[model samples]
Target: MPRAWTLRSRPNGMPTADNFELRDAPVPRLEDGQVHVRNRWLSVDPYMRGRMNDVKSYVPPFQVGEPLEGGAVGEVVDSRAEGFAAGDLVLHMAGWRDEAVLPATALNKLPQLGVEPQAFLGNLGLTGGTAYFGLLDAAQARQGDIVFVSAAAGAVGSAVVQIAKAKGMTVIGSAGGPAKCDFVRSLGADAVIDYKAGPLVKSLAEAAPKGIDVYFDNVGGDHLDAALAHARKDARFAICGMIEGYNAAEPMCFRYIMRVIAMRIMLKGFIYTDYLPRMGEFFADMGALVASGQVKSRDTVVGGLENTPDAFLGLFTGANTGKMLVKL
Candidate 1:
């Protein structure tokens, strides 16, 4: 038997440590075409917060009384599938449980990249992949461009900065604290702005007087508006995550949306799963970047399976600098 966290209630505002409960259960068994995986690492991300409430969104909300679900890395402990065997590491949409029985289709065999295995949950996985595609394929950044990113110390945000920098762009990032700003600078950002200290619009103007060519938005609300005001002609905006307004009761104001019409800005919101077909190419490019030391992957490990909920809640409060993962 192993313990797992289950949703106790849909959160009304910011989640408390009590919105979830930890309980024990028997390890699941594999049926035909199914493989039983012993989870080793679990991801805790800001996107999961949107799925906690029973609201219409990009993905379905987490059902009440069900074990919370998200991305995880695990090893096959038993298999009823033909191609998989015990000890093979894989990635799946398995949630907060210690173990799971999933159809082989949901599992992707992880490559032995010789980096930390957890990088499969961070840089080598969807986080890095999202930054790669969203910026290159979607935003289409070019040489000598000015790029700005929000939530810039996070796993995905950090990757966006490095990718833009490597492509010869001047990258400016906005984070919450001086520590996170320093981390962003260390990642090769040309300028770092601490949004918590003063007005974001003024800071962006001072840092990027020529104006921004790409806006990789992770924190929305005021951050989004400020970036739009400073966007250069034909700028591209990738609306990734909106941590600033995740817990808000009403939608954040977008008074500057008129600028999109006037400026002809290409504004788009994306969910990484929608670009599944391009994942092969995306992963290959990011792999080479990591191999050549052009991009770096990082994780903040939260120990103990029982503490998973706290780790997930930390995403909203900026408690993590990179990917937040739980080690069992």
Candidate 2:
């Protein structure tokens, strides 16, 4: 029998294993216009945390006792649809399980990018897509710009660091500790701040004394404040993820709210799916970057579907340096 993980209950603060259930989920028979797949990889992302709450969001909340879903790469074992056959590789949203019978409309043949199957879950999928559109479109980062990135050693942030470097931007990245800071530096950041060591406001000022032309925010709170305080006139900011306050009980307060007015900064909040119509452009550009080796992936993989809950909890704890995945 195959298996699937379900949301047993909602969490009050940070989620625990008690909130998830791994159960026997035998694969079902394929209906017309559907394909049966054996999932090979499952993605765990920060955004999935918000979905766990039974609140209204851009996407529907995961129902209790139902299988949780995320990015997944799988192989087709059977198909009742055109353009799909056995042994075909596909990407779909039927994750948190080992096998699924899904509609053909919800499936896509993995682009012939020549990257590994798992890369689609990391650099080639949401992680890379988020960074690509967030930086270039939302932040309007240009060559010769000085940029600052929060959670610089993270999955999306790591890609942002490399992409900015490849495009000739002077980059500064902030990571929690020395090891992560070193990791960000190796991604070609001009300056790496060990945010755990000292004040970020001071760190940003020292790193880019000329002031930053762009800010890519992954962790909000102090990072947002620091970017606001350090932003030059007409600076552009892309609000990506605010992982710092995801599990917080109270609202976040920014200390440098006045900076936005003083410096005339433009803040743009975006979701990668906003560019779905523009995926051709994203693939054309990002695929070349991947081919050039300018953009690569660093992933922390947890093996087994039973460990999916642990892998998801790891996102809030900074347990992953890059992409966090469960190898199904």
Q: RMSD per prediction, one decimal?
A: 1.2, 0.9
Candidate 2 lDDT trough over 10 residues, lowest sum: 22-31
lDDT tens readout by residue for model 2, 1-328: 8888899999888888999998889877888899999999999899998899999988999999999999999999999999999999999998999999999999989989889999888888889999999999999999999999999888999999999999999999999988999899889999998888889899888998999999999999999999998899999999998998888899889998788998999999999889989988988999999999999888999999888989989888779998898997
Q: In model 1, which range of ten residues has the least summed lDDT?
A: 22-31
Clashes of each: 0, 0
lDDT string, candidate 1, 150-229, tens digits: 98899899999999988899999999999999999999999999999999889999999998999998989999999888
Error of 1 at 255 (Å): 4.2
Error of 2 at 250 (Å): 1.5
lDDT of each: 0.88, 0.92
Quick one: how many clashes does candidate 1 have?
0
The residue ranges of model 2 lying beyond 4 angstroms of the native Cα positions read: none
Query: On a 0 to 100 scale, what is the lDDT of residue 84 in model 2?
Result: 99
User: Using alpha carbons, what is the TM-score of model 2?
Assistant: 0.98
